[model samples]
Target: MLTAAIVAILVTMVLALIRAFLGPTEYDRMLAANAFGTKTVLLIALAGHALSWHSFLDVALLYAMVNFIGTIAVMRFFEYGNTRDNEGSGSTP
Candidate 1:
């Protein structure tokens, strides 16, 4: 059961990667990338369960944090043109 869930997540991750590569608009690609990151978290957790590796959960947690931060950073760049120096810009600061 867990293996099936892992496989499904991997399949979705592959599709998301295709979308990221083929998306016409920047936002479309960003959305796909975000979805890919989310799927990666799920895959890691499933692998942890299947392999009985407790450390995988820790890695997954870290990956989730990084994914969230990365998505926010990307969106901030799209909206403000820079991740740094968004101070007082009112768009992302």
Candidate 2:
């Protein structure tokens, strides 16, 4: 069961990679990247269980935190970027 899950995750990760590369918009690519990271975490957790390793869960947790922060940061950047472009760079006197 664990092996099957790991394989499924690997397939999803590949699909995410393809989307990240071929996505038509920046947001689409970002979403794909986030999905890949989530799948990676699941893969690590499952692999660790299958292999009887103790520290992989911790690594997965760390990766998950990083992925969450990175996604938020990227979303903020995109959101503010559009507003900045529309609002202009000139300071009000």
| Candidate 2 clash figure, as a count | 0
Give the local distance difference test score of model 2.
0.93
Candidate 1 runs further than 4 Å off = 82-93
lDDT of 1 by residue, 1-93 (tens): 777788889899999999999999999999999999999998888888888996998999999999999999999888877545656668941
lDDT by residue (tens digit), candidate 2, 1-93? 777898899999999999999999999999999999999999989998899998998999999999999999999998777565556768663
- Clash counts for the predictions, in order: 0, 0
Candidate 1, poorest ten consecutive residues by summed lDDT: 84-93
How much is the lDDT of residue 75 in candidate 1? 90
Task: Report lDDT per candidate.
Answer: 0.90, 0.93
Winner by TM-score = 2
TM-scores of all candidate predictions against the true structure: 0.83, 0.84
Model 2 residue 56 CA deviation in Å: 1.8
